[model samples]
Target: MTVLSQEKPLPKAKTGEFWDHVQFGGGFGISAGNDYTDITIAPSAIYNFDDNFALGLGLQYSHLKQRNFYNSNIVGGSVIGLFSPIEEIQFSLEVEEIHVNNTYSDLYNNIKKSFWNTGLYVGGGYRADNVTIGARFNVLFDKNKDIYGSAFMPFVRVFF
Candidate 1:
């Protein structure tokens, strides 16, 4: 006699699967000297739609001082999009906007200046595990009003 066996179908995936793909990453820095002080904090989160695509948001804050020269506060936010064409390469595009407030001091006077700045960055980097190292350029960089000395910046990112 011959017997026949049947296999059951697999179950479907549950809802709210999007939350499973979220990742977080950012960095901070602090420095102080007899005549200078700088502090920065930035935090960000991203949601991966798939293995190769992600969208995210970030926040930034910085405090800087030069004794008897200038003191400044900077606050900003950014929106970023990431794509990985292969396992080892990733590319990104980001838009950032920040407000800067500066107070300058001299022997006899104090001056205050405030303004908003925006940057559009395009970059690519090498990826390994949860880290990416690369350089980015600001398409909207203006040396006169931007905080960075140059339009190009190097970055290292880590996510889990």
Candidate 2:
């Protein structure tokens, strides 16, 4: 028997591209000056522009259940660039505008005496199958309060 082939191969993709993923996940972690437990609930979504870059949106509301901070409501998004300088490691750059609740302000207070606020958070992340972990540094863009005082959190995201 003899066979003939008449098929063309596909083109190659660029490196450090994350334009092939649509991600949705949730996270729970803690924060403080030390080993303190701060229960946080955050749901997030992302659209990859390449295999190495993505745009993300997240909505998070956290109560200082058993820690140092008070109740806060945050909604923000960021543009992330994925870089893999080594195997088994992924680094991401994030610039996000997070709106938080200022519990003590000069305006009318509702929603747990929380006032409106906005902040810019820069962070990095590492990805794994069915999980993602990262840390963030935030700068409040408001003149009311500075919550978190900048928090270092190790977060895990469960993909569904």
Candidate 3:
């Protein structure tokens, strides 16, 4: 009599393919000075289409107050595109549209204004397995709209 051998099945993948997963993270920043203070929080999601390209979207909120003078609130959304030809570096470009509300108070009068504005940012930076550190420039910067005081900005991100 001859015996037959049984075959074993391969393990199944739980999360599906590499492109099927999404990465998420958020960032925060705060600054204080003698006459001014600013705070910002941004949350984002990204989907990698492949080893070299990805796309993302983000939401932003910012608050600014100056000593007994004026205060502003901003809310916006952004879209981003990223490319990495090398393993440890990547390039990114982003565009954002925001709405700003400002209120000013003084001995004379108190006034308020609201408007919608847009900004463009382009930069490149070093990237590791789950973190990236980069500096970007605002290509479409307006002094009234860019509360950050400069066209150059630095950023850090983490993905899971």
Residues 1-160 of candidate 2: C-alpha lDDT, one tens digit per residue: 9999887877667653554466777666667655334557677777755555555666666654323333445555444445544433556555554555534322454335444444455555576754567765555433346454444545454555
Each model's Cα RMSD:
2.3, 7.6, 3.9
Q: Please rank every candidate by lDDT, starting with the best.
A: 1, 3, 2
Deviation from native of the Cα of residue 159 in model 3, angstroms = 1.8
* Model 1: CA > 4 A from native: 1-16
On lDDT, the leading prediction is 1
Q: What do the candidate models score in CA lDDT, each in turn?
A: 0.95, 0.54, 0.88
TM, every model: 0.90, 0.51, 0.80
Query: What number of clashing residue pairs does each candidate have, in the order they appear?
Result: 0, 10, 0
**Model 1 agreement with the true structure over 16-109: per-residue lDDT tens digits:** 6776888999989999999999999999999998889999999999999999999999999999999999989999999999999999999999
Residue-level lDDT tens digits of model 3 in 66-98 = 978999999999999889898799899999898
> Model 2: runs farther than 4 Å from truth?
1-20, 28-40, 63-81, 102-116, 139-144, 158-160
